[model samples]
Target: MTKTRALRLSGVALLIVGASMVVGPPASADIPFNVAVERDLGLSPRQAEARFAQQDHASAIESRLRDTLGAAFGGAHFDPSTGKLVVGVTDPAMTAVVRAAGAEATEARYSQRELDGIKSMLDETDAPAGVTGWYVDVYRNRVVVEVNRAAATRETSAYLDRLRALGPAVRVAEVTSSPRALYNVRGGDAWTTLAWRCSVGFSATGSGGSRHFVTAGHCTQGAGPAYGYNDEQMGSLGGSTFSLFGDYGKVDVTSAAWTLAGTVNRYGGGDIAVKGSTEAPIGASVCRSGSTTGWHCGTIKAKNRTVIYINGGAVGGLTQTDACAEPGDSGGSFITGTGQAQGMTSGGSGDCTDGGETYFQPVNEALTAYGLRIVTS
Candidate 1:
């Protein structure tokens, strides 16, 4: 079996085991219906109950999109994995907006049979330089590209074309922009896993001119001496843990000086100013910027989720969304539709090409846990 498939299969296996243990039988008493949703989706009971409480208008939106952009787009599916609607479109421009909407849209190219064979081959070989990983998402009908940190926009576009050149059955649909700051950082730079790498921002602390940024606990190890973007004199891991893991540790401010900005760069030629770290409502829209997958938007799927991490144990009270992220994308930022700081990237199982669910540590919790303040303009 190919390595990608193997990884995915292994992840699924782990999920099953974890799920069996985490999701206990429902209580005999009148348990809330939302509790069942949380249990089934591998979410902590709290998250499921919260999502169940909110009114979901996603169905109406999906219906409207179908009527408004019929034929221009193909079939649509809501990825429970990402909590965003995956719209199939034939136009690249339309698909681009889908990305902006915080949903993922892909242009259909090859038939599933041909794409499957290509995916098998791609999965077997070590990914090319500037390519982090790839995934075959049957739900979205595309091969998702997880680009390397050093990958340039032109290079990413070239690689997409290369995939198309392989055969008439293969075609390039859409490409998500890379995060500018993350692209600026060198490869192997140490960073915390913020909301599974959804968005990242820099910070500073200590009376001795220590420079660092607060990220999600799910981003780095609780016991760590973290490194800088260039493998330089970054800060020590200081404190790290999955909040849900019942380990609340402050993100250490490294000695390395990082640029503190008043804006959240979306990396899609647009940006949202960092006003304050205010939490958005459950159904409110949100966006994220990260090193791996650039800026992507989606609605708040659920909040206060407790996720078990493979590396740093488990963290609770994460905000779930339909946004996409990759390995290096962890510890990034999640901002509300109005540009309020919501959370940090944690992690998930899919890629930006087809879409995936991402969890984030709420910013308020991060601030309260760390006694840090958000710098604003």
Candidate 2:
């Protein structure tokens, strides 16, 4: 293709990823993760627990594969049904290396390095209109791009044509309604000050050692003095960022009555333990707790994605999921298995009623970006 044509198609890979977890409330235990799995996936409590245990083991093997394969590594994910680690390798020779680590190996067409470079080219393009989002899907070994329509216009068609020149690594998907950043602070929540209501994501300490609770940046934007759910005034909004680089913010909690806990409220059920923020692999089961949806489980669809919201400009480097969320659920907690903090709810297409796709700002990325540590037991 000509240079001009290549430039037209050079938007981000924009792929949709697939992974699964659960929505729960089980009867109660040291961890309620199994309960969610059982509830959402139709698995028995014992089976759900076993699946998580398997995922943990898969995660360990994945770590080994990462160190062993290095640049040969394409990507890693869990087999949702079997809970076995699936490692993608650019070289067929590396299959033995991954299988030696107790993971299923699959040869991939594109190397992770090449994929990353292509993604960088896509990012360099001006935001093409009507394009909602995109990400890299390792399972498909392609960058999946989501468009509002297949044939929106001649320009978009030309753009996609150029994108195809980059190789078979880019695929376009047509989607409904655009992604939006949900900002709603309301009553009867973790910490809602104004009429708008946003849920708390995770409580942490800033680099300077001040206690604060993290949430969606869009939530804290224009937020007056924040108040606890009990209607007591807490500290004001501190460091916050909106849909630009990422979507995350922190609210200083200086009140004596409102001590931050290492647990996420499940709304109608048990509190989720906050073990750590180590992100789970793709296709692992993940659960989100929002005031609106209560608790919903799904799989990690994709990572390092960019979702263009209606009002929140363009927030990049997000994790996509089929999990459901609504307006008041903004900034709620997304956790994997028993207790790993995944991300804060950004936005999605539909609601819990009919099911929808949502995106999150990965907790680890947010923590690293703000130099904050999640308060954990």
* Per-residue lDDT of model 2, residues 162-252, tens digit only: 8778778898888877877765522114555443556788988887878888888877776457766555777788767875478888787
Error in Å for residue 233 of model 2: 1.6
Per residue, candidate 1 scores C-alpha lDDT tens digits across 274-340 of: 6676555445456666655456666665544444343443344566677766555566667643446
**lDDT on C-alpha atoms for all candidate structures:** 0.49, 0.73
lDDT of candidate 2 at residue 327, scale 0 to 100: 67
Leading candidate by TM-score: 2
TM-scores, each model vs. reference: 0.45, 0.86
Q: Count of backbone clashes for each model? A: 41, 27
Candidate 2: where are CA atoms >4 Å away?
Answer: 1-36, 185-189, 193-195
Relative to the unseen true structure, what is the C-alpha lDDT of residue 201 in candidate 2, on a scale of 0 to 100?
A: 89
